[model samples]
Target: MEIIHHHNLAMKTEEEKLPPLIQAIAAREIAGFDNANNLHLHDLKISILDANEEQKQVSISMPSSPIEVHVGSSTLYPMSDSAAKFHSQPIPNNNKLKYQRFDSFKTWSGKLERQISNLRGKPCEIHENDDIENLPLDRFFDALEGPELDTLRASEEIILPENEKWPFLLRFPISTFGICLGVSSQAIMWKALATSDSTKFLHVTPEINLALWLVAAALVAAVSAVYSLKVIFYFEAVRREYFHPVRVNFFFAPLVAVVFLAIGAPPPVAGKLHSAAWYALMAPILCLEVKIYGQWMSGGQRRLSKVANPSNHLAVVGNFAGAVLGAAMGLKEGPVFFFAVGLAHYVVLFVTLYQRLPTNETLPKELHPVFFLFVAAPSTAAVAWTEIRDSFDHGSRIAYFIALFLYFSLAVRVNFFRGFRFSLAWWAYTFPMTGAAVATMKYADAVPGAGTRLLAVTLCGVATVAVAALLVATVVHACVLKDLFPNDMAIAISGKRPKMTRKWRHRYRRRSSSSSSTTDSDYCQGN
Candidate 1:
């Protein structure tokens, strides 16, 4: 590229020596020529007239077909006009430029002229004789004819592309079963509160318990239907979820919800349905337990210590829930067997989490609510032991006290549970609180007193308020915000990290700087 500086100006190699306006115009012209020709042939020349000249012009010349530019008071004109006549015409100074070019140099030269005019704060104009078919917009649409146009029309008919067009049922996650688990546990807590002698003065009624059970049952049915469809239509997705370390724990939730429903069944249905449901559900629970628990002990990729998190408590708690239901239905030996299996694993899992083992999985702050499961497991075990022995015995008392201690241990760390945005993980708070409330009620029965009764009522009230707040927040999040179904399939199918939103990205950065133990992959698995 050669630049000719006029008015006795010295030839300088540095582009910075040119005036700012000329420099910008020259740079844009060079870029346009390079893109259009896709070659490095340096045959372009730019002529810059002295600023003091009466008719200062910046003319760009190309080897193939040259075009000249005349700059006059922020307006551009074609080279065909004479210098004297160009100034004589009364042209509107709307800062618009008009030019004509040959077919060979039409694309790049026209773009260069428009950009130069714009650099001088002016618009580019097309002459009346210019073909409308050669306009940029018309050319773009012309290229999209035939198959491309038909594909565009078909896409416009649908809301999303073919790959992303998933039915609502396919979007439902197994973790959503946690909602049914929470509601069912709440129903059982209400039933226990109504039946206890020491809390009789609170005037809790059977009707309230029954109503809560019905709501829980409806939720279970809906969730079950959606998940069943997922299993049939997207069985691969189901398989992926089953293999996830954190997500696999929630697969036990639906069974636990069904067990709670059976335990909390009204007096009329409790007799016939309780025995039948216990027998039917027990087989599947034991089969899953054998597979999962065997893997935990046998030493492989699925070792317990490797995947241990507070969420794993879900699997342990299911066994206790089954034991409680089994004992309630007057099964003597089966409940004891399930209780022993659950208690053995509970001790190991609890200690692993407490020690914060180096190999154990770490959850992000958003999932810290599952830490409350520490309180749930022991509390459910306490209730199971009480039902098995037909009384809140000394052994049951010890378990209840452990649960009470853990509840206060977690409750005092207010910051650990606050500041997290609403998610399905918030459902983690509901069942654990309800479990503690039921344990406290049983404790109150063992030692009747005003203080004991007050403690039970307070825990029950807190559990009730937590569940109600979660329900409202979930409705607003899913309906108003439209963020409930993020379709975070990366973790399961692709082994890629879920994309973080702006708020979560900020939080992740802040937490990352403060702590180095957790990594980006851990955050993906936790969510």
Candidate 2:
């Protein structure tokens, strides 16, 4: 035992004699090493890298000293729920301390590795998200307009039908009313022809006057035929207007009655038949007056501002025309009633229209029914008054004077008249002008004055010139212009196209093809 103890002391003395640096190097070479192939980290209950990768609380025994954890060369602080992993080889329990420096070149790489689990538990915070739900909806709505505010308003457009649009001869059936002028002028000429004393002033014989009556009668027939075509083709338009709750359309009724009265004066079977028709028509005309007048009063004129044109007095003119016809037929009661109604209603209409109607410049010249206000109503009244009283009485004189003054007012604006477009409304000028001429002749005969005779002669000359011009224009428009039919009714009963329509259609086809080609090329370029 003494020898064994002496040998152990000798070996310890030799190892203690070795260099200190060699001994430290030998210690480091034998120390435990952690590497990627064998090292792992897990929780007490589960591995963070498990298939489910669910997070759970882990109980770990913390060391008093700090730990140096390495993951892919990244140095990390101690994890809150970490468990140290070791290789299959057991590490020596030594108290030796060691330090190692990391090189910049190999900074992001290491022999050891680590895996992160439970990605949902360590989600990165987002700075901003522009979801629509996060917008200030209440603030936006508060800035909007209120419910009472009107975002849109209305405007008016004159949408003329293709038929009534410009470049048509029979654009409107209202032109048929021009028949009244021919009939009235003929009646006056016939009266003058029958008077032996009239030859000196008129410078025409009874035979010439008879020929004029025949011509006037022919004109009446032509107009009636044209109007019949209008009724057949445009029944709905005529019916709607005829029964409208307004008095202007009522004028056309009396115009028909005037034709009957004119024909009745000649003492023939045709005259008797026309007179009978006139008598039959009187009842319906009276009914129409009552309906229109009653509605005008009751409705308080809902559209008065828009419709208060001088045409409103046309109703009054109709009554007077009826009175003249009734007197010619020797109907005492009818003439008196019609005359009174016409006079009273016309006064009211005149006052209202004068005050309320738009200015001349504001009104379109094509729609100048206002000219009739000064001419037709007063002249018709004068004629009716002369028939009732059998002379130029106070009422007849007053009516004549008013008619003359109104005529002058229109005459002074001759340039305006010339500026007017060719429309059915031009027919308005014919009736009033003829009526004035008739009134002048009646006044001259009743007064028996030189000045009156000269005035009568001048007016008749003017009426003749006007009628002749209108006739030429009508024939030219119908034959040459070929615009006599309204739109779709352009084809005649014989199924022949109008000359103008054939030309227009050819032009339309050429333009349409050119426009279509241009549009197609434009579309291709755009695409």
**Local distance difference test, per candidate?**
0.70, 0.52
Instruction: Please provide, for model 2 over 21-48, each residue's C-alpha lDDT reduced to its tens digit, 9 standing for 90 to 100.
Output: 2111211222343222343433244334
* Tens-digit per-residue lDDT, 85-155, candidate 1: 21112345453332121211233434465679889998867543222223232221222212111112111
| TM-score for each candidate, following the candidate numbering | 0.64, 0.55
Q: Give the best candidate by TM-score.
A: 1
Q: List the residue pairs that clash in candidate 1.
A: none
Worst 10 residues of 1 by lDDT: 147-156
Which regions in candidate 2 have their CA more than 4 angstroms from the true location?
1-172, 179-184, 193-203, 229-234, 243-264, 267-278, 300-306, 358-361, 483-527
Q: Clash number for model 2?
A: 0
User: Candidate 1 versus the native: TM-score?
Assistant: 0.64
Stretches > 4 Å off in candidate 1: 1-167, 357-362, 490-527
